[model samples]
Structure formats: C-alpha cells, structure tokens
Target chain A: MNYNFHWRPVMKALPELLEAALLTLQVAALSMVLGVLIGLGLSLIRMHMKGPVRWLATTWVELARNTPALFQLFFFGFGLGAVGVHLTPYLIVLIALTFNNAGYLAENFRGGFKAVPDTQIRASRSLGMTAFQAYTRIVIPQVLRIVYYPMTNQMVWAVLISSLGMLVGFRELSGETQFFASKTFRIFEYFAITAVIYYVIVKIILGAASLLSKRLFRY
Target chain B: METTSRFFSGFTPNDLWFLAEAAGRTLWISILSIGFGTVLGVFFGWALSVTKTAGTLTIAPILDIFRSVPLIIQLVLFFNFAPMIGLRLSPFDAGVIILTIYTAALVSNVARAGIEAVGMPMRRSARSLGMSYWQDMRYVVWPIGLRAVFPSWIGVALGVMKDSALVSVLGYVELLKASQILITRTQDTLLILAIAGAFYFALSYPISLYASKLEERWSQ
Candidate 1:
C-alpha cells in the first residue's frame, strides 16, 4: 500500500493526449456520417425492397446488432486480410464502426418510420409530387426529426466504441494512453486523465446536440 | 482467396469447442456482472425514486459519471490500477467488478424511469386503499414498473453481453479473446471471426425475440 500518486507525467503529456482525443472525435464523426447514410439505405431496403436484396439488408442489421463491435472489427480487418484484402487499422475501425452504427440505427430509423403516420406520405403523393419527391420532401424530414435524439445517442456510442481502435493499433486516445502509460509506467494517472477526456467529449457532444436541437426543433 | 486457402492448413476442428468454452465464459461473466448490477441497481433506483435526503443528491452525480464514460476505459483503468492500490484481482475478477458497476449505473436509470412512469396517481390510489408502504410497492408499483422496465432491461442485458467482450483486452479468455488467440494461431481470421459472431448472435437473438414477444403480449 505504499503507492504514491503522481500527476506530473500525465500533466506533461496533456497536449499529445488531447490531440489523440481529437483524432478519436474525428474518426467518430466520420463514422457517424457514414453510418447515417448506410442506416437510411438499410432501413429503406428493408421497408420497400423485396427478394434477396431485402434479405441482405435484414441479415446485416441482425448480425451487426447481435455481435460485439470488437468481434466485427477483427472480422472485417483480419477476415478481409484472410482473403488477400488487407486494410489499414484506421480503415478497419472506420468500416467496422460505420457498419455497426448503421445496423443499430437502421433499426431505430425503421421504428421512426413506423411512428410517422402513413397518411402523411399519401397526402404528399396526392399533392402532385412523385413518390421520390414525396419521401424526400415530406416523409424523410419527419423521420429525421423523429430519429434525431437517437442519432445523437448513436453518435455518443460511436465515439465511445472508437476506443476499440486501440486494440487494432489505430493510436486513438485510449491507444495513446496505453502507449504513454507503459512508457512512463504511470498506468493509473494516464488512464485516469483519458477517462476524464472521454467524459468531457461525451458531454460536449450531448451539449452540442441539445443546442442544435433547440434550433432545428423549435416550433 | 489464396490466403484463405492457405489458412486451412493450420486450422483444426477442435478450435470450435475451444471457442464454445470461451463463449461459455462470456455468458458466465455476463450473468455474474448483471446479477451484481441488479442488486445495487434496485437500491440506487429506489433511492433515486424517493428524493428524501442529501444521499440521493450525492448518489445521482456519482451514477452520472459511470454512465458517461466508455466501459472499456473503465475496465482497463480498474484492471491496471488495482495493483497500485494493493488489491489483488485476477483479470476475470477485475472485469466482472467494473462491468457490474457500469451495468448497475444503467439499471438504476431504468429502475428510476420505470418507477416514475408508473405515475403518482397510481401510488396515491394504492395508499388511499390503506396499503402500507411495503404492501403498496409489492402489490402496485412492482407489477407496473417491472412490466415497463422489462423491455429496456433486455436491451441492457444485450449491451452488457457485448460490453463483456472488452474484458478480453485484459487477457480474460472470453469469446472475443479466444477469437484473437485462434486468429494468431491458425490465421483463418474470416472463419474464426464469423463463428465468433455467430455465437454472439445465437446468445442474444433469442433473448431479444422473447422480450419482443413479452412486449406484444402485454399489449394484448
């Protein structure tokens, strides 16, 4: 029990660790953008498409949601490498995270779609708009609004899950913390600092989301 | 494809059973973690539901911190730091302890919300019927609140199972860790990884389906 707490090593590494935290945020943001698009596509395919195409959509959502993201990351990275399709660790995490986020959010978006009344779409259709126009102009807006908070939740999840990048050697915040912690032998201090950073990053995302929602959702 | 073909040479069928054992470890750890969480979660949830004292205010912020951070970071921190604090913990012990803390945080939220969702009028009506506090809760609040909470509890259970994968990083030989070991040994990443994913899917899908059925039945 003679362990002495030291913060000096962690203090000196703040700038470097903060940069790594920013990288974590960047990867998470990029994944969120990709995930939303893929999720929307999956939801539409599951809803409107038929036959094998729809089956593919259904399978991706089920498999992704049911499996651990770590498993998916390894499966995508090494699995592809097993087939002579190598990917960088960065690409591996981005793709795995995007796919995972898409799978979860596709289901969320599907529920959002159900929550919207069918009459809204029919009304837009009868107003001389094409089916595509009706969906984009009328239905999609409502779906987006309905899923906005859940989208924020997914964004937070994507940020947190990106820490798995550490395992795959992507050098995000957690990876960088491990690197510094081992080098300085200040394991507790290094991890303690990064945990605070993660907490702050999540708070910022939630804060920004609420601020943005205040504007977009104001009636 | 050639790499995949070459990988077949090092692979053995028994690795499937090895993974099955690992999957069993994953489930075992999940049950222990969630079990611990349920006990503390109910206490904290009940505390948060009743805003009677300074204790509730203090506990709320502490729970909020646990909820905010990633579980992986928490797991790694606890595993690495326990030695410094002179507490000896095996990787499995450390993993289960930290995950239980995280799970309890989430479960408490579920409990608090579920209780609130039962509404005050229902509680007041039960009180007017001359039921004691314990009797009122046992008869009225528990039934309604638990029904509302059941669906979300299943979601948390699924989440805890996946989060358990993170314990593998600390050298706990769970399903994900077993997959990593197999990959390094056999080099058949695609097959190994897919089988691991299938194991997880098998574990979670039925729980989700059953929860959905319960939700539907309640509607009926």
Candidate 2:
C-alpha cells in the first residue's frame, strides 16, 4: 500500500470528466424525451389497435423489455453495421438507449393510461369533447399524474445504464474514471469519488423529480 | 442445424468449443452473483424494514448511498483495495463481489415491497392466533409477502443476468468480454459481437418472459 497519492492527476482530469458527464447527461436526457414519445405512441397504439396491430406492438414491447440494453446496444452499434445501415458510435449509442428506455417507458405509460379511469373518459366525452380532444386535454393530463413517478424512476435507471456508453468508447464519466484509474493506479480513490458523484447525481434527480410531480399533479 | 452450422462456419470445431466454454464463464458468474445477492438482499431488506423505527436511521441512508454509486467504481475499488487489505482475488471474483453488492441493494428494495404487501390485517390475524412475533412472521407474513414479490425477484434476476456483462469491464471472460476477445483477436467485429449479443438475449429473455407471466397470473 505504498502507492503515491497525487491529487494533481485527478484534479487535472476533473474538467474532462465533467465534460464527459455532460455527454452522459445529454444521452440520458435526450433518450428519455425520445423514449417517452416513442413509448407513448407504442402504448397508445397497443391499447387502441385491434387484431394484428395490437399483436405487433405487444411483441415489439416484449422483445425490447425482455432483452438487456447492453445487448441492444451491441446489436445496433455492431450488428446493424453488418447489414449496412451504419451509424456513428454516438448515434448508435443514442438510438440503442432510446429504444431500450422506450420499451420500459411504454409499459409505465400504458399503466398510466389504465389508471385514468374509464369514468373520466366517458365524462369528458359526455361533455361534448371530441374523442381526440378529450384524449389530448383530459386523458393525457391525468395519465401523466400516474406516470410521473415511474417515469422518473426509469429516468434514474437510464442514467445508471447509460454508464455503459463508456463500453463503446463514448468517454462518459465511467470511461474517464477508467482512464484516470489506469493512469494513476489510484483505483480506490478514483472509483470511490466516481461512485459518490453518481450517487449525488441520482439523489438530485430523485429530488427534482419529486418536486416536479408535486407541481404537475395537484390532485 | 443451419443456423448453428452457419454460426460456426470457417471455424474449426475447437473454435466453437472455445466460444461455448467462454459463454459458460458468463453464466457461471451471473448465477453465483445472483445467489449471493439474493441472500444478502433478503437480510438487508429485513433489517431495513424491521429497524426502520428503532432509531438507527443510518442503515437506510447507507442503502441509499449504495444505490447511487456506479458499479464501475465498486469494481475498481475491489481491484485496487483487495491486495492492500490482504484479501487478494482475481478479477472474476472481484466482479462477483461487486455485482453481489449491487444486486443486494436492488433486492432489498424488492424485498421491502414484498414485506409491505402482506398487509396489517394478516399481521393482526397472526398475533390473534397466540403465535410469537417471529413465529407469526415465519408462518404467516413471509409466505404471502414472498409470493407477492415473486415478480419483483424475477425482475432483479433478469437485471443481474444483464449486469453480469458488466463483469467484462474487469476483464472477466464473460460473454461481453468474450466478444471483446473475439473482436481483438479476429477483428470480425460484426459477426462475433452479434453472436455474443444473441447468446445474451437467449440467456436473459426467457427469465424475463417467465417473470411477466408470473406477474400477470399472480396479480389476477
């Protein structure tokens, strides 16, 4: 344990890690937005569509939800290129994450849709709201109430999972930590701090999400 | 036969054997970690639940602390710290320890939900039957609560299976590590990585589907 401890190396690398953390946040945040939109569409279609359409959406959801996001990242980042639909490394990672989050988010949103109660939908319809109008103005707003907590939870999961982006050379926080650990061989100090940083970020996310839920869901 | 044979093309039977052997390492690590994780998690969960009002709020905060930390840091910590602590282990062992801790944290959450799901009425009924508290918990509360949490346990199981791939970062010869090996050795990036991905999908999807089925059936 006679290893030399230098704060200089890690401090010098801190800015780089911060930049990488921004990339990590970007990946998680953008993927979350896209995933929600994709998931909402898929869940709405699954709920309303009849016959083969419902079957298709259900199967798609099952496949996505069941498989690990890592496998999905590999399949897209590596496998799709084999078939000639090549995307850049970052784009592949982004798409992989979006699809991964969408599968789970679709389920959360679907649960939310169910939680909105049939009586409310009927009430809105009886009030002369068109089907489309009622859904946009009433159903979506109410569904958001039930969906907010779970979606936020999923967002936290997404942030953790996005740590895998380092695997594909995305140079996120984990990736930078790996580089710093190797350079300094101060693995304990580096990893301990990285873990703390991640912990702090997730706690902040949870706090913000709870606050957002309070403001958005008054009822 | 076609798929298997095509998957093995231009490679000797020995090469295919090596791939399967490497895949075995992946499954072995995941299963071992999950087993360790489940036991640690059950205790951790029970401790968290039973001690919530005992004025030791430290445990829950620690659990929260563990949940927030990244897995990579844990692995790195073990890799560097073990030798200094006189508990030297290989990268594979280190990965298992880290994964076990990570899985334990998640499992405790799952277990807490199971405990809460059993309801106070069930607890009250057990008390009214003249059973000691531990006796009642062993006989009455645990069964229903554990059954209710079967789906959550399965979810965690699936999660651990996927997380086994993270062990690759430690240079373990898991599926992801094997993929990296193939890519480095052969440079047939697509074919080898795809094979690795399929192996993972094959391993993880059944557990998840079964869990979904259980959730659907039990919730009804």
Candidate 1 off by > 4 Å: B1-9, B52-56
Candidate 2 C-alpha error for residue B151, in Å:
0.6
lDDT of 2 at A10: 76
For B86-189, candidate 2 gives per-residue lDDT tens digits of: 78788988988888888898898888878878888888888998989999889987899888998879888887887777777777787777776666666576
Correct interface contacts retained, every candidate: 0.79, 0.53
**C-alpha RMSD between model 2 and the true structure:** 4.1
Best by DockQ: 1
Error of 1 at A174 (Å): 1.0
**Candidate 1 local lDDT, B1-220, one digit each (tens):** 3445453346687999999999999999999999999789888998888875664678887987888788888988898788877899999999989989888999998998888878899899999999999998899999999999989898998999988999998899999899889888887788888888889999999998898789879867
Residue B98 CA displacement from its true place in model 1, Å: 0.6
Residue B53 lDDT in candidate 2: 67
